[model samples]
Target: MGGFHRFYPNACDLRSLPVQEVDESVSVQEGQRLLQSGLLGGILLRVDDVYQVILSSDLAGEEGNQPLKTKAWRPALFIHARMPVAELLEQWMKTPDAVPVVADEHGVPQGVIDPLTSAGVLHHEFTRIRSYLDSILAQVNECICGIDDRHKVVIWNSKAEELYGYKAEEVLSKRIENFFSNLRITNCMHENKELKGHYHQPTEGTHVLISAAPVTHGSAVIGGISVEKDITEVVQLNQELTRASSQVKLLEQEIKKMSGQECAFRHLTGRSAVMQELIRFGKKVSTTDATVLLRGESGTGKELFARAIHQNSNRYMHPFIVVNCGAIPNNLFESELFGYEGGAFTGADRKGKPGMFELANEGTLFLDEVGEMPVEMQVKLLRVLQEGSFYRVGGSEPVQVNVRVLAATHRDLEAMISRRQFREDLYYRLNVVSLEIAPLRERREDIPELVHLFVQEFCQKYGKSITKIEPAVMTSFLDYSWPGNVRELKNAVERLVVLTEGETITEQSLPENLRRNTYISLVTTPAAQGNLMNVAVEAEKQLILKTLQQVKGNRSEAARVLGIPRSTLYYKLRQLGIPAKG
Candidate 1:
């Protein structure tokens, strides 16, 4: 027994304990006498193949004459010999006064557990479990804080100390509200609810993703636990990134301004001397609020220049509304310029609509082909321009606006005014700062640049790869007078790029008019120094000779090709002193 006690301080099982085995024929009085002698721990009575435990304390004053089987032994809990120490201790602890009987696999009683040893084992196991829980709380990465029902801090893990700068010794057992006045852990416990992935700012310049839950034992609130992840560095980084982005944008805007690629006018391009001068002058004009009148031939990019002016102006950020006076019907002119109210007329907008002036408020209003406006409407337009206000079609209330007017036209407004077809006062009012845009022929140097620009533009659009234009084609382009101006030239280039089969544009791919013009330019270049009549005769003679040569000296075919009567061709042959035979 001394050897067993040294090897296993807390007895692992009852196998080595003292026991008294007796037959059921033994009288209960004899069983009690033997147990009271204190030589054994318990008495096991055997009847046939079964055994039952009878403790001496259970039969204290009963000296019955009946057999031990008839003794008054209360029901006992039987534990297996192989039962773990924790389980044995738990069973003994539940009914502390009842000594449990230990048995083997075959229902044979071994012995009874010692009450003193079982109590010691229970305390040892509880200490081991507590140490394990403390180790887990100390090593986890997330901040852990726990509070009891009294709102006192019960658990503060190592991570909590690192994040909140409060040691466990300093915070434990203290009211949590004293440390974090706005903590949601208290709210979680009060509401008896759980919070998952909640963002919180516990202190200034600190951010965290926190989760909290109330600890409950059988529907009764006992405490609460909260876990948090510190995200202060991440939040600071994001704020710094936003400021850096804003600074980069500001730098980019400043660079564009220094390089003359200002936001709105960057797309307008021209390098010719006349165009450069006009652009410079227009840029100066764009700084003021005075009315601007753009004058040019039809298709001379009048509207484009007007847009560039507006874009360069102070009102570039606002809208630039264009109203084509020639395109609007005379009857709808007033309503279109000055919008109508709701139910003003049949088919009008039900909620009313703003007109060009209202839409162009704080911006530029470009009245294209302004000469085409009816004389009556001209008076109303002049009045609005003078007063900066106008009444809607159906409403009597005057609508005031601050719009800069830009008028464009290809007609001679002075001539129309002289004929009384246009209002003279209106013409003068619109011509405050007249800007004459030169036709494409007058600024012929810009044609090549415009041509290449259009070529690159159309190549990408039509999926073509025409890289170069034949020298002859470029020469013809230079000589041809573009009556339709830049707009016409752009269309012609688009057509050529689309129709040309190969990677180069040649004279054959040009339109019929362009080809004919090229031939006339070829013949007229040498005689350009001669008198007007001499140059004209030389051009005519070269045309006739080239046609006759094409048909191998057939005069009738030559005359037919020239679109002239055969007799007139012969008379011109004698008149120009050409050989009649060939």
Candidate 2:
């Protein structure tokens, strides 16, 4: 036991030299010493007058070994120690709701690393971290919170409570949907897979930011961890930062998504017009023998669309194979895509296994990032298309494929053709039926619907309810440009869902990046003149109106503040559609 640590054995011992008694509970410190001792057989101590001791399986298994009693999780007692080990074991025995701990090689019992301690050290650490976070949040002056696995409100920070008119205690055990009013919070979470900088909640006029990570145990997911912050005011001050982050990244990840080659279109999420259109097109082209091409931005669900196309085609009943032509190393492209016969290569498969084409006969074959295919492979593919045949290395038999082809890529084939990097002839062949997917920003109207689907999905996934969004949130969602496209939007929506403390989402639930500042475009040309003037007047009018409202409709005071006559102030207010407060 001492081998794992630096502790050395004492020169002299008080009790019996080596071996002794049976089952009994001993004091904790004393039992530790006995286990630390070099020589010992069995020890015992009476715990609450009940004698019990744990026996080593090694000794018990021996033909003439001693038999001893044992408990599953609790430490065993050795009867040979000077003091009864039973007394030590009894100290922690029958303790209600104790967490299990594994013993190290040296018999050191411990659980997670400093996570559950309530000692001052842990308390201080948590406090320091919280304080630093709070300071940063305060500098931005935002409201933030997060949720647990069941979607319960685990982190209703002071600011959140202050803005929502609820105490942390009142909101702690409840799920976010229980108190929220907007439905968009769930939607935003679904889009981004993370809540960006600041977001709004279901509570009107309040905004927040939320982030989360999942916690897993074995094959099951125990729960998740999340963080939140409110930055409505701060974002308004610096609207240039409206781009928020994704929730998937914010939350702790138990499993990695790996890469596209490792996944058959995993990480894809969509159910909008863009998604439906691709499916409809796939169905149309898949039934026929025509080759299909899927074009979209990177991470815009192209591979997923390709896989779906193959699955629904006439080849659905057969082996639907996928090949990432771009991912195959240039040197190994031929061997990997076109398998070798026995002795074809230095270390070819002795059985002469067929290439992807042979395996995909009478089925659907998907080519991802086909633009990345080497020119040599392009000619080979052209041969297969022109004549339903290809030769396996060292084999004379030409393999015929009744296979349908579906190819997808993020690159512009026309641009690649201009560069002469991709084969124009092959592009024309594959482009018999092309499906172009619109980016997320192009179809902003579909966002609301898409967000809802994700929220509902995540609710069932995390065993949580769908929280809502604030009214002001959509203004930002619509205003911000999603460069990462629908995929990024989906991630944000998921983040918002986990961060919420209520059912309704609000502007407060929208991420900071979603509510970024409006850039002042300088357009001096006559065509853009009207646009710039209108924007300016609108801003000035709103500024005056907001200032007037702040003073509670004091027209005289507003006029004085604006350095204008009361009549002029009233006229301008009427023109801007700003109503007077009673």
Candidate 3:
């Protein structure tokens, strides 16, 4: 049999690797001492100018027997000292039990690069890579979390601690659901799939957009990783909007009539011509059983409009049920919309409960966030609308129901139809009477009234006696873009009413973003002296500063939420004389 040597020149250099060398004349006792001292992993020897490597095993029981010699000590496999570390590793892997000796061109022993040394090197490299990954995760602005196949928390970054209010030390090795029961990491791990852009509320008062995927090892899933973007502010704003919209609805219902024309739509408040026209159209549609689609952005009071339509309809006295299509899980859509029979599936109600269609029988069914409805459910809904009847889950008999379907959404159904996400048949069915409610920005004329309404509502609720809002504050309200629409405005008013100590709400009580955004109006102020450029620069600086503060000095997150590139944010920071640290 012939022995062969392998080498890879550029793979890795073995020259820097530590090796063990000793003269062949060393006694067995000395070799044992060297091995026990841990100064050398393996010993290299030169016998008759030929190299031999001796591991600790070779010296076993030889201490009291005789002096180390060619016949007594095992001759380990040998390689050239100049061989690349790749070849060394390959040799070690192929012959794991054999220690290797590195020798010169003249066959003189240089040193031994044994299995123990290679393992130590690999462990060191792994630690370095792990440390690098940890540092990278720390800098990321979004929350990053990971769980192993055992369903234990394995990785929790700094942002995760900030968002979820749990430290890595406290959560590591614990079941993920113990802290964030709403997190879908376990689901991803079990299903071995990915879920992105999912709206999640990990804990009360904390809302996030989560994207999670299974971490796989070839054909097997080893773990799961999730990234969550905090959207608590946006969600809170929308919630505030919903509350304010509800308050407005309540107030309108209290009034006997609003100029007689808005008697039916008193719940839908707006003095603008567009709003009045929309109200008139809503009232006209409310008299019939036509399927009406309320189109508007979130927090624009789409549900309120639907209720007004339902209340004014002939079946106003019947049951009016509201279903948020976006909030329902896809798997439960069928059972939720069309009631399931007893023992329909596992964990089902023994006695089938009525679905939205059955509950809203003979009345109006308001489907909010209809665009978020699954494509499969859209066909079923279309059939119900067209046939005026549908079968329940796990039932053979057809159930009849008279439901005036009123659909509302903040998404563009036309675009979704083009993308084939939404059905055109359903769109046509629901679009019999389409009303596009104007956003707060477009109907800025109604700000004062809406502000007055929200202030009174919040003031009465919070037990505050705030009666007046400063003109400047109101101007800021009008000038500032209400991205959350009426909801954002309502939230701002509520915030001011709660925070303000006096009877009057002032600019100082305004939220930081609201005040900073109104800087464009500063040019009109007496102190500005018409310095538009200065006013603009100061506004930009304040906006950047506020954004940075909101993100807790994370510039990357600030840039992302502000809809600007990270480099652009940095440039603006420099141009505006702000620190670049965060």
Candidate 4:
């Protein structure tokens, strides 16, 4: 009763069958009519709380006036309403009755169970299970092939069809060894052992990693099953990566050789006092794993400073990853910064991916245009900065990374904090050691050196031999306000080096804006109404001072700018009593 309790009152409902009740006096013809009306089995008689089962076959040959109880009928089998449906079926199967009466604990008739209804439920459940398994198998990328005891292929999935270039229909009944020579399916079956992680290249001309296991039935090996993964692209990528790594090593060696006599921060070239001070501070910070914030205008070489700091640090051998916060779409920002697990989204990689923080582990992560990062992301970033750990998108595990963060931005973060556009805690976290880069116009004294370096770089790149820059061109460069900073100067120098035809770049090679601005400055400034010699000398002194400022007190460049011999410029400086360095 305990086992049959769940099915008691409505055992017929378990198989979705209907119940038919009858009294002892009910005619056999009436029971036949009830069975024909769709009751698979009918109840014959009820005495004291027990109902007798009368099957359709028992009333088949009986006369119309004969009572059903007079024909063959089994003793009533009673079950409680709380009895299990499966346990009721088991007990019913042991009896001669085709149906079992269901009742509640109070002894009231509920329903009965019919065998036909039970079969329908099992069929539907098995079909659904088969469909679910088929869907999973069809979508899997690895090739799976199985053979039966006769060595004939019994299972060949879609991925197997794609990998071996054979349809499932062509291989279903075929012997696996006859079609695939390198599969070793026969050996696995005969030896009853597994072949794991074996690299194979079959005559069909495909690189695959194969693993095979013997299928067993009782104590005997029946056949074999094999899983194959295509790795041709992976192998090719590994070869290319090896070559790239070798080239990087050679480049590193060359850089080290060139930097043997110079400091690691030698690329930051300038004689300006502000430039020197920034360099000194950067060198000091690079020795430790400190979070640094670089504040500067666009194109002012903030990324360059970040790289210089990374290269001079103890973590130089590790990665220096740059994340452009502004370039990423807002919706994809979290996934891009923190990565995601497989199936995290529709287009995510199956094997999952490592995020920027994970990739920059034991290294440095430079967040360029950090101010453009969304407000919500700022809170997450602040937590990562404080905790040194973060969870991946759609993930639960916290990943720890020992990375030094360097953030750069052109926007005013202080104003952003007031507006609630940037997080205050994140601001303090990133600004642990803030450094500012002065704009090109503010440090005009660095232009001549910067120009020389850019020209030399581009000349070598373009296979040119240009070495000298015309003094008029230098004077014009110093006169203009460079709104685009050092990046703009580098581009202009590259253009001049590529287009100029002579060893010395002439003033005509300068951009039209620079030339026009110099001409306007000269024409607009009023001159004294006096002797021509006096006005010309005054103009010469002004030009000399501008040139000195441009070249950062480099006398040779100043003399060249004035179109006077170096000795003559020195003599005139002493005669005119103008400080030569200024």
Candidate 5:
């Protein structure tokens, strides 16, 4: 016991006692007697020079009989007295029920650490550390899966159980590949590589994004850890957004259709049979990809019809480009139509520029006054129409384009073809569908409606109001031949609205060529002076003739304009010896 005190001075000093030893041959009865006398809480049993701990509880008997040998005593944990006191205390704290035997360098028992007293401080610190770690792991939202080097699952967090539908007890220590074949953890361990944003579909309708990393110690990969985020809701939301976008596009198309029907064709208005038929045909051609040739006078609204057709087509979302063939210079026609390369000419742009055809790709191209294109350029235009490809100026490569061509011309293409002024091949190509707008003179019945429409339009533009037109002014409009067609009529009405001061437009406010008396006399020949009755009768005859002509020989319209009954007009026509029908 003195040698034991020399070996572990501090442990002996703390208890203020010397070491106690028991022989291996001592019976459990003797050991209980020592404990009852309060001489020892535990004792060391010597085996040669080594020592083992024997707790006082080991002396208990099953039925009042003691064990014969120490072989029946449970194994004891030993510590060297030369070790630090703090380490010795920690060992006792981990196993509070087991006694620790402190031995010397020669393995002789030096002291014993009473489990009840040494474990109190260490137990409190160990419990606090364990609680902190468990709380942190429990609060994690991402599923955590960890695997050892042997490919067995070691850590399965609560989030993992919720996400993968498996409990920790069921999967721990099991082979990970048996449950999930393509887990990133297995791949990361085998490849020793970090994977990020890896997508995996474990089951139907279950999508997860996984980020995994190799667990390494001292530059050696020993295990793998992976974090999984459930992305099923995100995937579902993206699919729904795609479907909603498609529905919105369809609704926009329907709205454009209704708008086209209501106002896109407002420029092509008339009640004449020929004009009605032209409008119906134009509407039909608007839905097709066919080339359209609009033939009419300059102011006949051919360009307006072209725009309406484009607005009603499927390519309405793309650009609608207009190129005036007659307006572009003959020298720059080819370059303007087909684009140019960098430094193609002395004054060309350094970066080059896309021409009308390229600009109008996937869209409509309106070539107004197409008959004005030179004969040489007509061949190039025909090639683009036939092949859907063309070469830029000074460029070796041919550019491809998808474009719909809509051509308008006031010139007589057939007559020009005869004189070789226009290419017959190009003419045949352009005239896939032809529409001819009737001159305004030929549709005289539409004049009043056009005048009213123009009045409303110009009034809004100039911020003025003129709602009424005198009967004499309207009669002059019906009788005059509008050589410039609807455009000319529009200009005349706009002038009246802007320049007239009165709320009503009268004959005094009319232009020189559109006066009532002048138009009536122009349609009838002058007669010599005569008696009052004769002069009055002559004037009435001239007025009736002019009104009949103005209404395109419609007797009902004629009587309406003249403010006479149809029956009275018929009787007067018979008395004047004039035919009622033209």
Candidate 6:
């Protein structure tokens, strides 16, 4: 039995100790190679049975006094094992000076390297190959199911887990055909031939692609692996594109269904359940002249709905005028809608053209940003709805043109009514037929549909053939709090379609603010906040209080730390019922 002194040299003469850098990039194999090279001495670098590296512990010099690296050596070997290396090391710590050996009969190495290196060769594999598998499995958004000749799952990746609504363990030995109502081909179990390639199923929204490879062991055919990839999204997308393409062709056929040569609704595609409800409502309300108050966040296609309503009404052929109440100047409001005579005011037209209200005679007029309409004009609007008569700016003659009113606003007019900014009478009059359109956030479940519509329309409109938003981009799009609402989303899609120059929109193509973190601000800051002042104040109070604990209890410093005025800070504390200092 050779002791440390035997491994070194000269019994009590010190020296003959090998020192090495612990953090060198040398792996276990390299370390073992060095040890087997017969350098100077054999010193195993392992923890228990598992060896990380085996180095030569030969040291230079000899004398009565010992070198620090030689004498101060409390050497131990560490190993990277299948189980926790540190745990294995802790278990076999027999003695302080005991050297861990692989076998008791003789010293021989078991496995002492990376688990992967132990399995495969050092072939040219991409560094991210593992990550790629993880990602493919992760991004396998389309739920997939894998089965064999017996219809038993040989591979149950995470996506299969998500798609089929089955846990991996639960479905591993089970048949995949049990879950799906329509498993396209029954030859999936045919022992004669294997199948390959994708199969598209319309209306069902499921694409079943089967690729089969025979399993052979000892040169005999046992069974086969069948990979089923669900491509419903891809099929739906293709259908949308096909629909958009055949619009003109289908228009002729669809027009024959209705009596009037003039169609009442223009085309905008939406097939999702919510949009279907909207479409149904649109068709139902279009035949009437009732005052429609369209309410939704900005960009939610209120104006589009309004147009559709007018086109479907009794006055389909009449002019449909659109006016943004917020965009028009306060001074020009009366003339913009009611129109002025030759010399009504300073820059009147010689012949005089009618306002949006007159232009929309016998048809429908869409009033956008109705929330921003001045309280002063609310009286004139009420007069029109009540008596159905209005005078031009300079003319005393009441215009007798019959018209329908459809007003829309992104703001909460009810809330505005409570604040005394909006007229309650006008609210009741305009809200004759109220349609509350939900924001994109509340309807996140409809993102796939919305994205499908927007991506298809915008790409075709902008001459960009981008088919889909990348998985990451779609994730970010769903996560982002679109304050500007659907309008913002459309603009983002347009921007991505134009700028990305690819078949898909990526997260990078979106605005900097949008491609960020998702957790909707639990607390709102004063800046970047909307009319929800009370919510913002409460949120700011919560954020300040939570951050205050980091510095213990220092109000003056806390205010400075919070980036708010000390006086303002005190006021906040008083408002929140939180005591200051004492």
Q: Which one wins on TM-score? A: 4
Instruction: Give lDDT tens digits, candidate 2, residues 1-582.
Output: 224432222111112223333343333434444544645433433354443333232233333222223331324322222222223224325542232222334633222111133233334545776777567545543345555556676666666666668988898878877887553434443443434443445556555566544445444554444455665577665554433333444331212222222232223344456665655555566557788888888756776677656554445557878898878899777767667789887877788877787788888778888889988789888888878888888888777777788888888789988998888889888898898977777766555555666778777876777544443343345445778876787788788777777666655666666655322221332333567567556555645754465345788865654445779778877887777656
Worst window of 10 by summed lDDT in candidate 3: 1-10
Clash count per candidate: 0, 104, 1, 8, 0, 14
What is the TM-score (0 to 1) of candidate 2? 0.43
Expressed as tens digits, the lDDT of each residue in 104-153 for candidate 5 is 77976666666455455446645775676577668988888889999899
Q: What would you estimate as the lDDT of candidate 4?
A: 0.79
lDDT-best of 1 and 5: 1
lDDT of 3 by residue, 199-289 (tens): 9887888888989999986588989999999999998899999999999987775552433334546777777789988988888888888
lDDT of 4 by residue, 1-582 (tens): 234322123344454344566667778787777888764545547655556777676677676677677774577677776665566766877885445666767966666555577667656655876786588669888888889888899989999888778998899998877786745777888888899989878645477888988898657887888888899788778889999999999998677555622456788878789999999899889888889999999999999899999988878878999999999999988988899999888989998999999999999999999999999999899988889999998899999899999999999999999999998889999999999999988887788778888888998899988867766677677778888889888888998999999788988888899888876665556763456665545555666776777666778867765556899879978876788664
Q: Could you tell me the lDDT of residue 540 within candidate 3?
A: 59
lDDT of 6 by residue, 477-536 (tens): 656767776788778777777797877677678777765442144223344355556554
Worst 10 residues of 6 by lDDT: 6-15
Question: Largest lDDT belongs to which candidate?
Answer: 1
Model 2 CA lDDT for position 275: 60
Which candidate, 3 or 6, would have the higher lDDT against the true structure? Answer: 3
Ranking by TM-score: 4, 1, 5, 3, 6, 2
Q: What residue runs in model 1 are displaced by over 4 Å at the alpha carbon?
A: 1-266, 527-582
Q: After superposition, how far is residue 478 of candidate 6 from its true place, in Å?
A: 2.2
Tell me the TM-score of model 4.
Answer: 0.53
User: Candidate 2 regions off by >4 Å?
Assistant: 1-282, 501-511, 517-582
Taking all chains together, the TM-score of candidate 1 against the true structure is: 0.50
TM-score against truth, every candidate: 0.50, 0.43, 0.47, 0.53, 0.50, 0.44
TM-score of 5: 0.50
Model 1 residue 457 lDDT score: 98
